[model samples]
Target: MKVSTLRMALLIMISIGGVNGCGGSGSSNTNDKSVSPTTPLAPETSQGITWEPGVFEGASNFAGRCATPRSGVDPFTGASYPDVEGSAFEEKMWMRSWTNNTYLWYDEVDDNNPADFTVASYFAQLKTNGVTPSGSAKDNFHFSQSTDEYNTLAQTGVTASYGFSWEFISSVPPRQLLVRYTEPNSPAALAGVPRGASLLRVNNVDFVNNNTQEGVDALNQALFPSQSGETAVFEFALIDGSTLNVTLTSQDIVVSPVQNVTVIDGAAGKTGYFQFNTFIRTAQSELIASFNTFIDENITELVIDLRYNGGGLLALASQLSYMVAGPNQTNNMAFETLQFNDKHPEVDPITGVEIQPTPFYQYEIDYAAGLLTNTLLPSVSLTKLYVITTGTTCSASEAVINALRGINLEVVQIGTPTCGKPYGFYPTDNCGTTYFSIQFQGVNEKGFGDYADGFIPSSSPSFEYEVPGCIVPDDFSHALGDVNEGMLFAALAHASTGACPATTLAGNAFERAAGQHKDGLSIKRPDALKSSIFLQNKILVPINAPK
Candidate 1:
């Protein structure tokens, strides 16, 4: 049902209740969007609800009804397929998911908008604009869909792309993307696409041909491919203003989370440095191997680079927390806690079974997910770990930081404020599009989980809606693990001194480049959709109830 229609329906109840025997002065249900046992109807207090009820057509794509179980259109691919929401079919599903599942539900959305809101129009309204993380009553973080991408990226630590992820440098027309990084042996890496390279053109099209939206549309079409083996020629400008053109075929690029691992022989000691990109199942083996090497090296301190990581699997996150804290330090403690919504019992809502507080996982979950494998996960059991971040660091990644603190470990957070997201959900797919609504917020053993606007540098005064911590900007000129790089250097210095480096304000590299940055910084918008993190890899509950 459209938000407008839903609002009208909400109002009708008041009058209808008085006319019929359903009289009640005000909504008795505290959870407004939820359907309580006594109040079958969800509540809404939007001004739009006061208008006469508009027809609940949904997005013209749903044929005026949800739960039709028909294929939806892929707006990106225009494919008549199952699971993806390119079609008009998703408006109803999207509305229903938030109405039924989100923590705030009816209190924070545009409920009175026309039932005719398109997918893009409605989605735009849902985004939290300038809203910091500390404001928990309303949710503005956008982008929710199928877990298909999440599952693949987490399970194998791979994705079907040209072996590289990118960031768009141009905000206006003729938008150009900068190659963020390439998977070591993937097609893009083989094609010699270097980090910080300017993607000037794609498949003969000028990325910013002329019109603003047109350029964006062109870049999206050429860069984002739905299937593997799709071929596209990329043109990049190298450091010397020289142009290099290379043709690449897309494939499932294995993203070993441990991008670069080494023992840094610094003034402090032999510190183990690990640059992690994503939290995938494939990370387990490499992580174990790396820690074993760390133990062999007798490393006293550790530095973890998570500047580019947007979270992945929570289980892997738990495993990593365990590895860093070890059994001796974190013995029998809650790695994190997952609390369900108010509508359900304080337990696993779907299984009707109970579960312990999310613990630090010590072993890899089986392929069938039936048994916990006997293979032991490795750990260093350090008292502290140095972590680097950018605004992109989020979700399960934040969980690692949170869980470690929960178990009495010191996590020296270096870099700028992290993307404050203590909430997570199992991606659910239905009617061709996947749905993800925030179901719970997590806390540490100290019962402190409210870091919504993000953890800022320690020097910044504690104010409303701010997370206090170290502050630093991303350093693009130096490679990640290099001790001289901005964030890493700050972390290394803090590892020994235990004092946070001064917060460095991020520069407008886009303006500096006008297309390319002289300092070799990659182009990224902190608020862009690409920067948002979706940490999956939990027990997903597929919600398909259509009424």
Candidate 2:
């Protein structure tokens, strides 16, 4: 229903409560955008009353509806509908109210007692039913308010927020595995696998013609079957007709989400580089370490690379800005403001007695270290924060780009564009599965981020190569080289007399073909300048490469 209509209905409901009921601003309930349980069914002092359960629409795209049975027949061949195998639809319900910020479910609707079916009563209900949510259910609901409830579910151990998910699929039929693009610094990257090679098998299992998902799933399971990382074997068939088996352990190694920290080395000395890979949860720590490392190394030119990052945690993205741009830096709101599901059951501030829950979120900076540390953490001073970007950088990754720009950081971007993902989510659970949806929206100070189409890089890189399709074991044609030795070489060459070596290219092959430095003192550029490629502070900045 439209918010205006819902507000009218809520106002009418309040009027029925008598004289003291109309105390709130005559604002219609529909006008409230906060996702919390603020609707008052009982009077201010009322308590312990059973309430009826109702389903409310969640964010768009999920089609605000409960899980209902959907039966279908086999489409490929003749098969009876509903009776066909592998035809099952989810049967769950999701509800959202001001007092219930998450999507939750009840075993079954309690028509006889709807009020008792609400999420607010879930704790009490679970106790009465002698049931507990743990193991699979606990992992599904990563965030829970009840300490006891959380402890019980955590026993089996859940996949931490930053964990990886992989899908296994069968082999490619006609194409045969010609090559694989193990992104620079990816798992396949660490295995010393070059581009231009072939795949033989996964963990000794022969590749089936049509089991792509199975292959991916198998990889994930083998690599991270539980909370701990494990080693998995990959057998590759090179295009040269040679085969080799490589073993790689799935270690909990944290990727630098951010890279290329340097200051412009030329007369202008006005540019810098900083590349962000993902919004992964540890981005905050990694970014801090990077900036400090840059400062220690005396790098002034800045060229941020976010070309291949797909984004992860939004909170870390916000914190990254503070490390690079300094404190008191408020540009785009970190995450969208979130309202609590209810006024948590706490002793009243004035009377010291439990009361009905009310609105609790205060719009302000809630740093990673809470209020005390929010003011205590040290901040960095930066004149500019240039971002090197591409279409793959998304979600929380985009948050950093916008946040840096908001704080007036001089950001000169080079590459293609960005993956537009502006909203962030707080995962919740219901019916033994986790579901995440947009809970808040953030806009830069200039109000720029409706770009579902993605952000265009100010300067385009010179070449573009597919990430997943590049063959890593044998192909060196697309490798990133010394120009990418963590600094902007092209910018550096213009800043100094040095130039890139002739062999350096923009693809992965550059790594294998890069020429050694004269004495490891300056950035390198080709003598002929044939590639239109130059080194900025010894870092490789792209001119343009289409997604």
Candidate 3:
């Protein structure tokens, strides 16, 4: 199947709530395009343009015409300038028409006049205000960012940071934060910051007890600095009850998506374990190399750690799933099939191609070139798989579990419920802002995709939504890949004994704390606190057109 370059070429971002706080919002000077509920709609004659029912093609005529037209070559598409001077009303018109044509629940959206709102605010109100089965906002993933920043993060995985990935134990007053992990050679790792160290203060501002908005802003500014060379002093409470202070400088850090690939000898057998982070282009080579090692070592079982993995490319997920199940089981089978809104049942509304299933890709893909290579991918062909998850595990990460289970493979999940998201979209750019609105729902081979409430691990699973596993709390004291870590230990133990271990006091305490705090902690990079909604957590199409 030939994938359209316009539809396939880009990264998809997913919102993993609880970066700053579960409800704290992020903003950008260039691309802050959300509407406040209290903001009144503009008058019909505000811009001397009245609302009209129109199709997306009618809006396409106004697409390249920006209110403030940009000059020079476009960095992302490598195309010449097509922009022309236009009014903001024209931009808002484009947003309305495009959203009407593509948004999954377009019928549920209110047809407000475009003249009454700014382009950003107008685009924000284009989604449905419905709630999911779990009572969470149904269209929470609708958001936008600058086209340049979106492409840069998707392709390069580089972001400004001081290098500490934080896990929020609590996001309210008296917040409890801990170091989840650090990038190697980063300022935090170089300063000897270890996992599980509790954050105490930032530049003398009390992080735990600060309640005022001003104090919170100061803390956010210090912890999530926007530029390189910025410095901050941090105090941490170590595991041994000792306190330590460290001064660190921020820099442009490239994220390492794959880490801690180890082979563990257990009573069950040799288990191949790896901590897989994001599903970006950079992760392709690392995953291949790790799978090659596992194949050579003849490991019996596989444990994939996705506790902090938000998500990224869908093609990469397909590749990884292929490596896990191999050719015999996946041959001529669909990995996933996308169903767009009812209007475009037989064809993709975005790509204009006939609806088809995405296959279990068995060969290496040249992501930069957007072509498949002849080299075969390594696979363990295991019938049973182990996955470690958290609420942060979302989008393409959830797809991996769903796709494997669709094929009747045994998947034992360990940890809390996953962030439920089976929807995806091709990032659409108009003017300079790239909008991400849900356009399609992805289902596995069995035609099951309604998982909006998330996948839960339970002792006695009564439905397909529940899987047989232990609900273990995250173990911060022990390293992630350690044999004794809370989640991993339970997974290994369950593999050997086919039963869950007795619930411990620590696990109960963690659950109690989470219950008391409405929104449990999220694992995220320090810089992600503000714009954690734009993090990698969707299934991206390939970046190039098929040859």
Candidate 4:
């Protein structure tokens, strides 16, 4: 599954937002002020509005008060604009109040004056500045994007692209980029840009060694075009020691989140394998179809490649988990239980309803219609699951590994540590911008969600965060799902025999150098090129909210 240019642009924007931490205001007492203001406040000038120190008004008081009020109905939601003419200060106020009320770590945030910063800057510092146990940022998921962009990608999984998802083995000087995979029928695929092809240049700019700011900017623009119909010349070193240059035209492409579905005949019987990229709404049908094939083939083992899957819909994760374990093992068990801040212990702060555990969904969901169909999801009924991971495997993807383990199902992991993110939020759109604040932490049925450092593949596992599996580095030498690929091969061997194959670094010299990075053998993407914050999260739609 390849990333769309729009998705890449959004990810770059998110990267910028992360660097400029979400700004905040003076510290104040926590309170439930979720109620909408009965009467909208009269429009105020930007200069007239000032922060009242530690005091905060209800978020609703400033909600829909846009600096630039949108007049027409939202094309994505089909709802009339609730936007009212206001200053950017009003938007900042909404962010401040909303963070305090629903943010999982509300008190940890330093409240700086909203007037001191722009709306985007203010929203950036609204999260905790503390670090996790591993010394990583405590809240790495905070971000905001235009509501239109968020809705389009989340709903339809569509993006403008040349359909080349580059795997950044290294992003520094002498950077190494490879075609991780290409979308079916995309320009890259049509150009025969196979996996393992090394990216040498983009439109005459050296992709690997161009260190100048102007050159890097040119590379970013060409590599991630903002709109469809844009064209760029790419030079690639193909697998068979041949160089090829192709001019790819970016087009609007629907992402096929599930790809390479196959039933592999192995010593352990037929093993079902598929690379699941994102958990978007459209993935529901694709997943069902794949699982139905597994059922039909009577595969005894399952290998899910989530090395590039950052995540998407939480409900989709639940459904996938149910299908893996089936009704007998997960019949009445909660796939995950969401825990909110103490202020809203018994209720969800955003939905204003009693907290409920997310169950194993057994039926198909019409996400577009917001209805559950009567179609029973096909089950593999497997006792064990094989997962291929990397630092990019995150959120809903991690939830699958954790939830299955909670039910005592064996999950043999391959590759390096996963991008630990047991946290999630409801993407709340106020005015024209959607704010994604960490609202809750999800625990499995066993009440374990503390893998903030990430779930590591280890030979000797001592904690829940560590799982028994081979510590294999990704192989760029072979295409994903190919039996010769390092990760999948390790999984298949482990399935056939009860032992992991001996670790051997595969791929070319650049790949080996990437594996030898100080951070280990995992693919290293620039913060800007990392998976989109939208994808690297467990997004929730309030049960009571409009579909």
Candidate 5:
């Protein structure tokens, strides 16, 4: 009954790809040459989601803008709208449970209408039904029905209640264990694991006959034994019929959510690459460190892959943008903007005064307080850039992409369309939840590509006909199920030949889902692939959307 169960379910449901990449384009240690190739590959077949003329055409715009609640109330203050809307309930709840930090309860008892059977009533009913709402609930019952209803009811604290917990079901065949790419330098990769590898077993635990959920449960238990200083030795069977043993030492390694420094094969002796991830707290410093490493390498045609990354901490995004654009370049446009409901204007925590909402981007931040410093990170003003994208790219991610593209930097998209999560959310804490919503839209200096459902890349990358085996890179062979790594390879080839006819785009249904244009766009309707692309191509979709 604890909301953390609901949070995990929600995270899984909305987790989408958290953004990361795999594979290594042989290192080149810098020339600044550009390669514009003419690929003769056939166009990818159009996926079902075509440029169908309709309103709320894409998933993100519909989800981020239309579907989500436009307003919320401050549970504590009762001040609605502009004053205080929804709290960051999900985030806070997640952290609380994750940290085992707090115990809170909510019920559907109505203050005015006592018989309404408020949250309190819902709890009573759960007790009657023999369910305990406790922190340990996460380990036993994964939130199920309350989850389904929460999706239906955007707000968390509502009187109406339904609950779902994981129930022991009949024995089922084990599913292929899958671990996605999270960081370019993930321990999996540090141990030479590649993306797309199926984790068949952990430490010799055969999942072929065990329940898939049990396998995952076992894996997590081993990987995260305690809150801190957890270490484990894991042996994995890859889909390619190979096995690897990796010892992961847990030392509170900061999950550098953002990865930096990428290399795309460039002309003769150059590499074209780009790097931009999200704005977790340590983003700026990590990016700076990555930039240093990249400059040290000899790369030629550089690409700034900022396709689907929704915006995150403004300062972080701006810092990276400055590094690329250079110190001399003007802060071309507002880094970000926010809007408040007319009813609940936000008050400055320091000044203790009602803050005025403004449309101008500059006015939103406290520039006078030096909070909006204009210092630049190191700038590598590469002219031509191949931006890898998909529909999921959004917010601060889009800002960096648009900012560079506006300067006429050759920004060639290679994946799918990008998600339009442009509006910046000013995180507001309520009760315990962290509330954020689409408040205002953003535009580049040229005033283009703002709040658009997605950005269609100019060119598309093709997949390889001879599938690459999905084995951990260290143990990878040509024997596993056919995988189409050629798509990314084609993008790399584009840096050299300016044409990689060897690879062709995925068929039509995905074309529409990702975006109209071919280059590095993500498949919006990726779920559609479960029945089609997987059936036809036999290729697993990339675990992560293009950066």
Candidate 6:
């Protein structure tokens, strides 16, 4: 289902007339649990994961960073806290960027409250637009959390994990937590956890008990342990209905954002296929390499797989867009313009740095090496693009689609609609928490960025995918790049013939059970389970909190 560009444009135009133009926008202690799950006596021998070729890997840097200097007094308790300047700075940063500070609940807030609530939570309490229909979905999803886990991922393009992402179909008693996909060679894979395997229990605790808080807490503890190398017992049932128990020790699993790069043969010459998992700095090297292959093959069409990508750096998005469109088309085109609140729409709300449009970056930036070197970008000089997406595709990922389309390039979006986050943030850290509020709205070249409800696919009839192709359902049964893979197959089929296939998007179980579970109780998704899609290179500028 591919929506025509004219129709999409009209939709955006209509939405812009009525939208609020972008505005701004808790915890309970549960029964104390052991810091580490009780160790099991005997563990089963590990088996090597049967990995499909081209699955990505992760890496990390041993070099440490000097912590940014910060400190602030608690707004509620008047207790001057030192070494916590980031939180206070983060609060002020939001005060400047929130699209609608006019409607905040600042005057109504009590100055004297619990000491537990710091500048981050206090500023969070001020988000009022979330109550309205078109407002922010103010939830823990709007928090600022800090973790070494994400740092390793963004910097080195790697992360520590059990090597699998779990999806809970339901969140209550009788709820089912299934293995979404096991990273090749991940602990979960080595322990025999496969895609569609039902996670039965963790450390003897049922995945879902009638008690919501306790069950979630236990699941979180097991799923997202604080440190690597910790071991836990996992009980799961495979798709074939065989239930088994395996013990897995957390390891520094490298999570490569780029999954697969290959050519899908088609009657229309050749189509370059790239399964991109995230827009990280580490991906540039691989992208360059893949494009070199495409150049040699003389492939003009492309299919980009971003089904599971939760989004990352905007800089990388700009870089990829440049590679796709090439320097000629990218030269002066504003890839993106950040729209802040009415208060300070023209200047940097947080950094006081000049608010400028981010042009298509011609070079790659690697933060770790602290160097900006120009590499020969494999420029396809594509006039059209095919982006494989899902509801999970968001933030900077969406930016890629929007930016490409903004420049008059034909962009055919396949799979489910994007996660609908044109909004992004410069991750602010306060008290070891990375906070991302809807700081700004991103508009493309034509000034069209009205995708708050997500990009709906036109089911009017279209091909599987060719790149420069159409929208379709996500198929998760096979490994990426395999002809059996749904999205890739669609792209290949569409490339072979610029027409729709007689395909049935029947029973998209993966979409049916991704983070949509609300088991009788209000289940707030933590950042770890589902991360916030973000733009990189944007960081919090040091600012003092209000007295």
Each candidate: what lDDT? 0.55, 0.34, 0.75, 0.75, 0.34, 0.54
| RMSD over all Cα atoms, model 4 | 7.8
Highest TM-score model number: 3
Per residue, candidate 2 scores C-alpha lDDT tens digits across 259-314 of 44444445545444565544433444556666666666565555555544544433
> Of the candidates numbered 3 and 5, which has the greater lDDT value?
3
Cα error, residue 47 of model 3, in Å, equals: 8.0
Candidate 4: tens digits of C-alpha lDDT, residues 297-340: 99999999988887777778878988998889988787788899
Measured against the true structure, the TM-scores of the candidates, in listed sequence, are: 0.71, 0.47, 0.89, 0.88, 0.49, 0.72
Instruction: Candidate 3: count the clashes.
Output: 2
C-alpha lDDT of residue 511 in model 6: 44
| Cand. 2 Cα-lDDT | 0.34
Query: For candidate 1, what is the TM-score?
Result: 0.71
State candidate 2's TM-score: 0.47
Candidate 5 lDDT for residue 393? 51
Give lDDT tens digits, candidate 6, residues 1-547: 1111100000000010001111123221111121112233133211222212222121011011112433465442255433422323233333323323322222322222212233434444433323323353422224444544345544564555677764445555666666656766788877766666777788887775535677667666777655678888888876566888999988776656676688866677788887776666677788888888888898979988876665666666777888899988887788887776666667755566556667676665543433334544668899988778765666666778888888888777666665566665555443434555556677988887777645645535242112244556654455567777776677666666665465734444234543343445423332323222221212222211112
lDDT of 3 by residue, 226-324 (tens): 767999999999998999899999987787888999999998888999998778889889999999899988999899998887777888888899999
For model 5, the local distance difference test gives: 0.34
Candidate 1 stretches with Cα past 4 Å from truth are: 1-98, 101-154, 173-176, 212-214, 240-242, 459-470, 499-547
Better candidate by TM-score, 5 or 6: 6
- lDDT agreement of model 3 with the native: 0.75
Residue 161 accuracy (lDDT) in model 3: 82
List the candidate 2 regions with Cα displacement exceeding 4 Å.
1-91, 95-200, 204-232, 237-244, 248-276, 327-380, 458-481, 484-547
Whose lDDT is higher: candidate 3's or candidate 6's? 3
TM-score of 6: 0.72
TM-score of 4: 0.88
Ten contiguous residues with the weakest lDDT in model 4: 1-10
